[model samples]
Target: MATTNKTGAIGPVPFMNDGSAALGVPLAGLTGDDPKLWVRFYQGTWVLATFVPAIASIQQSFRPRGGDVVIASIPKSGTTWLKALAFATMARGVYPPDTAAEHPLLRLNPHQCVTNLERLYSAGQESMIEALPSPRLLSTHMHHSILPSSISKNPDCKIVYICREPKDMVVSLWHFCRRGKPDVSFSDLFEAVCQGTSVSGPFWDHVHGYWNASKANPEAVLFLRYEDMLRDPAGNVRKLARFVGQPFSPAEEEAGVVAQIVRLCSLDNLKNLEVNKPSSASQPFANDWFFRKGEAGDWVNHMTPDMARRLDAIVEEKLSGSGLSFA
Candidate 1:
């Protein structure tokens, strides 16, 4: 028998050892603390592990509607922040001082506020999706290729995609992966990221896929950059509001609704909130630090020059004809 680690439940089922060759795929590579062995899905080019086969297969059947609003991004690419922004925008009518303590926004993480395609396709999710009211708000990390076929074909559905600087994305992903699997070293993480070996990676492809979609179907897809949001949140919020057909009113604008939304979802504000910091309502990894350091250029502090150059080369090569450049 193969010696398994303490977190063996989370480890990959080695393809070599298994007799069911028909069921097993070749190992892509080892990554993260558990040295998670990865395998490519036959249906999608994206790689996941044997442990989460359900999550992979279940995600395929998820389809969003014309009324649905989805905040999409690769992992660690400002997903949390964008989720908060989208939730706040959608739920603007029932915000602070007006909504009670038991308000959905107060009680839930942005993830809870927005449905995930993967969650929707899981065994228990059919009822959940059916129960959700129409004009639903959702979020996803699925690549363009794997996104629900219905959503891509739907001309009326509005999809919002947020992109971030690849270097900063690497740093953020490193921290996020480290929290759950503390044994993963930064050096190893960086190499995996550079090699496009992380979950939902091949980073540039993820961004380019959405970017092209946004361009090809501007009416259906909206693309926003993290740096742009940081620089001019109000401007972007206004733009988003318009895109989603919820433009702020003169009274609301004068009352500083945009600023209020920004303050409510700020990293400092959300981090300090009781709901975000070790609360009963929070998810397994949910905590103050989950939204830690929502800045663009922090990668400069942690990434060495050689690593940065390598990442730049990767980005340059992948994004050569895309016309999109990281700031």
Candidate 2:
């Protein structure tokens, strides 16, 4: 007889495992305190073992509408920020960024406003995605290469990819994961990053997938860096708006809409919202988990000099000659 777990999951589920069957897939060994944090080598990309089924479904069934804007990034690489910024920018005409307290972003977590493609598919709620209005704003952690031809080859579908420095990304990911699995070691994640086996990792390949695409199709794929956004968020907002074919008009710019969007979506503003508060223990993820220190170079506080150097060397070597220097 199967036993019911605390989560109502039947049978003996692995700790931290999402309980998704990985049958027939090549699974990588667990790297953290959670024995179920398995990753699968799928289609040449390393993905969380649980997300494999969703990825397969997305690749086969996702139909991209013209003018759909897909927000792509390696996890923890300013994805939340980009989603908020993009959503605010695109919908400025409907909900003025400066004065809409009733704005969807103000009331809901950014993740709720812009659905994640894989998670939606995983939940079998893809119908929710289809029901969304056209020129929809969607988010994904999937690598560009893995995206189905319906999206990748659709010239009308725009992709905006954001990436952070590998060292900082690993640090952010460590802190983020630790919130849910406090026993997971930072060293294990750092090693996984270096070995190219972390969830949605082999970070280099994930970055390369979009980096090269952006290079080849600058108009269709907008490449962004988290560090650069910190320098001039308004500038990036303008760039994002323009790339999505929702460029700010002269009047909107004159009214300081860009500045309003920036302020509305700023980290300080979002983190304190009631909707994003740390969830109850029963919830799978607290909305607040996505609102950590959105700063660049935070790796310094968490990593030893030797650890930084080792990861830096690996990132540099893997990205060399690609004209996509993270250093």
Candidate 3:
């Protein structure tokens, strides 16, 4: 039998590492070459992350509170930016632009503002999360299948999922992982991504799950593209505001609420903040490394035309008949 923690859930280490108890291989370290072979599969497509122990804490324990908002994305797909936008849009009335001193965004990193359910559970903080007030802002990188049934089935809970152009995502993920993994070579990273063996991959499966779900349940899941947001931020911000049940009133729009929010959360502005600079253990990244060129098609600089074409073809094949396309 699997050992249980004090909360009566399976212990994070034993549950995830037992092959008889979980599907997929469990990773022992950070430098795995074949993530498909190293990471344990749970709920469905989500691999039990190497950094966490309590995959079952979410599936079996987490209960969604109504009006909860979740920001979902594969890593490096504009997660931090979307968190800022979502928080600003929802809290606009409470934290008007002129009230930056009182605004949480000014003092806290985006990751701190939006809690990650999996991370919280992994750290044995489920009770703390449950104590948070209604409309709690949560973030998750888990695939939809792995999310607790409480979240997926809760009509009142809203999920906003963002995906980036696959080529750009691949390049960005490679560079991002290198922050702590100096030994990882670009060639290995490229091959791992192409073969769908990187963390939280296969990439096609991860995004398409939300794409199809959004089509079936538009009211519950809002699918977004990172490049599309960059093209027209204010317009996209309005759309996001509407989805989260916080539509900006006519007067608020006239007062430039959308522009102010975007400016405050812009890459250039966020990169210069002191909260983001603190090299803390809790921060996802050590510094503003997450702010590197938020440009679309930046893959062109690093990937050969042939390299781009192959990844595109794989994405095309995987997303075929799904009625989804990323720029």
Candidate 4:
């Protein structure tokens, strides 16, 4: 069973003597962030964390609407793709497939199109998020258990979470961390990742949070796998549409609406866009950071046989008997 912190927040609190300390408290002798973060374990998951004003503000306030839709994921687990698909899925008639010229996906990075809950608090935009209209579109890396009570209890809210194969996810996250400059060595990072020492990880638990939620409340939370989505995106897109309560009409399907969304959100097209090309003001990371190889087995080039085996074992063990398998 998991425990609560001093703040009465439920989660995996690391090294808590009696589980009474507040979450996100900075500590010594840790090279936590990628040179800038003060990492913390809040209720058991990692956060690109800050304790003072940011956490204080979010913890005390920040309401979520019941009609909201959340694109939830562990970082680098196809967050951008999911956001684009969700926005495009909802904006179908508004932006229309052929009128991609005026589409927001054409103008803004996925991060911008869908506000990130954590980043909103970090950047002091909690009020803005709260003010978003009904049926808000947002994203979060928070585990399902730790999400605000307003969101978690809102029977009307919907969460769409996507997870990737363990090996591919780790590989992508490593490359993502090292993208802008030298941060952590891949070898060092690999061990830390396998040990579940990254933000919002023990990735398997993160996967299971929404996976179990989806099983328990299929209408409220939808769990999707990156591999499955990649293998059959149209079917997945259809699933997304239905989950979001915006299924395509027969007329829309006849107009190749499904095909357009898949093509429009394709990595190849997204990467080639000027907005996602190496530099852009709208992007927090390099536009290029989000566009690594989207293939599932890219880990082969990076992981040694032993390392690969280690991750495979962990994935198997963590997901064992849980009705979840990434491969």
Candidate 5:
């Protein structure tokens, strides 16, 4: 029963009726009249019910090359901070001494600095990937189940996976998930978090996959914990530098390069920057406050005791005997 407006194709949109629809393209079984499929026209085409799971699968199948340095994390798990740190560490030798502004670390959002594997592998991006120089940098949220098989087999490429405490993750996720729609209830969002139905989730599986990989090949995979980084960023930064084969110079250390990078990428600095604010060339969020309250344990303020217990139970069940627990 739904009709599309005359416009170009838009990406997938999921709705409450267990049906989904997209704009600008004709898709089978997306009509509102179908009892099983929910249909709506967003932007122009009918988004189909089947697109959600398909996109998830498609995104998961993305791969990186041997020369690539991949930053992998579940969403809202200090991904931005890790990306900045990694990017900065790699680019340390590229910039002139005492010239801070020229560093990509100072000027760009980590998302912009690193390419997503899914976007690069899409039909339009083949040429772009090919043109990139060796030792290309990349990022992805794909779980271990869907990671490109080559990543495990290839010894040349380096993978860094960052993890955050589940409580903070859920809180950050709630804020992020509600940005597009104002009325999203925390209880409903908590349900999605527990089920791993949120974007780029099934959280435990994602973390455990890399955890096992790091255990198996410590040199190939680097595991970072957000709490550890928060506690001793300088020390962790040094560790990351060594892992990437780019140890900081004694002069750089004395000049406090680690602290400089942290300050440059701090929530306050990033939030106020022109690139992150709306209307800039590199804005990462449609709305402001993307870097709000980058502290740990904020979930204690928002989650009720019952909700906390439910989330803990899910985590306990998934992490049992894995020898991995979040901070």
Candidate 6:
């Protein structure tokens, strides 16, 4: 039986570390001061060490059905916002994004509505995933290179990946991390990101893995930029619905369904919901932690001119030949 935590969510179960040392899944200790941030080097990328076992299990056990859609991204890169948009897009038929009074999104956090795939596996709730009705909506921070063959190789499974410019992502991540450990210096986090040791990082590699895949198989992988979404959300929502094989009908479009969805999932609308508000005593990070300044270029407020140029140069160098410029 899966244990439930104080927040009424399934609790994570401890995984047994058998003498599988010969498997070559070596762990990387990035921050000796904080074991929580330690990572494991797997398949040429760094992932949080705590999630290695669950990732392994997911690789071996997950069976993707034809309609499964995975929302993929690096952390703090507008994941919550994308989740809201995608969920609202996909479930619009049954729960009208504009008209429904009891839509699941209105009452549940986006994370609760579309749970992270790794978290479900880690919590011994894989059965919950299997039980959920299709077409299922899932999210992940894992690099595309490391996803299971059932998902990465399956032509039937669709991946919608969103990424932000490295500068803004770094700023958003630092603020999110500081929510738990208020004393963690921004410089340390920034340095960890620069060194490619931050969780699910080597930011360039993480972004390129999907960028290249989307280029290779445009139909299966939909690559979106956070800045682009911010600029034209209604257009993106239509694009999202179309990619997931649920394009809006002419009647629905004429009725302004697309505009309604864009408004329903807007950051301001979601951030203010009671379900997303913070309750410090009960939950370590209620949905509120995910709702920060949802604007691009906020990095200028936190990072100095030199820091921005340094990170931008590194990103430019790494992504030079890939045709995936953040400039």
> For model 6, how does the per-residue alpha-carbon lDDT over 69-180 read when each residue is reduced to its tens digit?
9999999998988988898888776667776558777777787777787777766778777666667788889999889989998999999999998999999998888876
Give the TM-score comparing model 5 with the true structure, all chains together: 0.77
Q: How do all models score by TM-score?
A: 0.83, 0.90, 0.86, 0.86, 0.77, 0.89
Best by lDDT: 6
* Candidate structures ordered by lDDT, highest first: 6, 2, 3, 4, 1, 5
Model 4 poorest 10 in a row by lDDT: 11-20
Q: Candidate 1 on 16-99: residue-level lDDT in tens?
A: 011011133433323422323344543444544432454455455556655677778887887777777776766665443134
Q: Largest TM-score belongs to which candidate?
A: 2
Kindly list the per-residue Cα lDDT of model 2 for residues 1-327, writing each as its tens digit.
433322232211111111233333333333433433557788888876667888898999999887788999999999999988988887766567876677778877788777778777766677666656566788888988899888888898899999998988999998888886786688878887888888887899999889999999998899999999999999999988888777788988899989989999999999999888776745446789998889888899999999998988987898999999886
| Stretches > 4 Å off in candidate 3 | 1-38, 43-52, 278-284
| Tens-place lDDT digits, model 4, residues 68-168 | 78788998899989888887877664566567467777766677677776666666556665444445687888878787767766788788999888888
Question: At residue 138, what lDDT does model 5 achieve?
Answer: 73
Scored by CA lDDT, what does every candidate get?
A: 0.67, 0.80, 0.73, 0.72, 0.63, 0.80
Task: Residues 1-327, candidate 5: write the lDDT tens digits.
Answer: 222211221101111011122332222211224322232232222222334343344445544555467788887899887877776666545532236566554555666677655444432343455555445667766666566566765687788899998988988967875664455677766775576655455677778889999998999899999989888887888888788666777877888887876676666777777666665333224424356687988999999989888888888899889889863
lDDT of 3 by residue, 167-285 (tens): 88888887877775666677677777787767777888889988988999999999999998999999899998788777888888788888999998888788778876647554335
Clashing pairs in 6: none
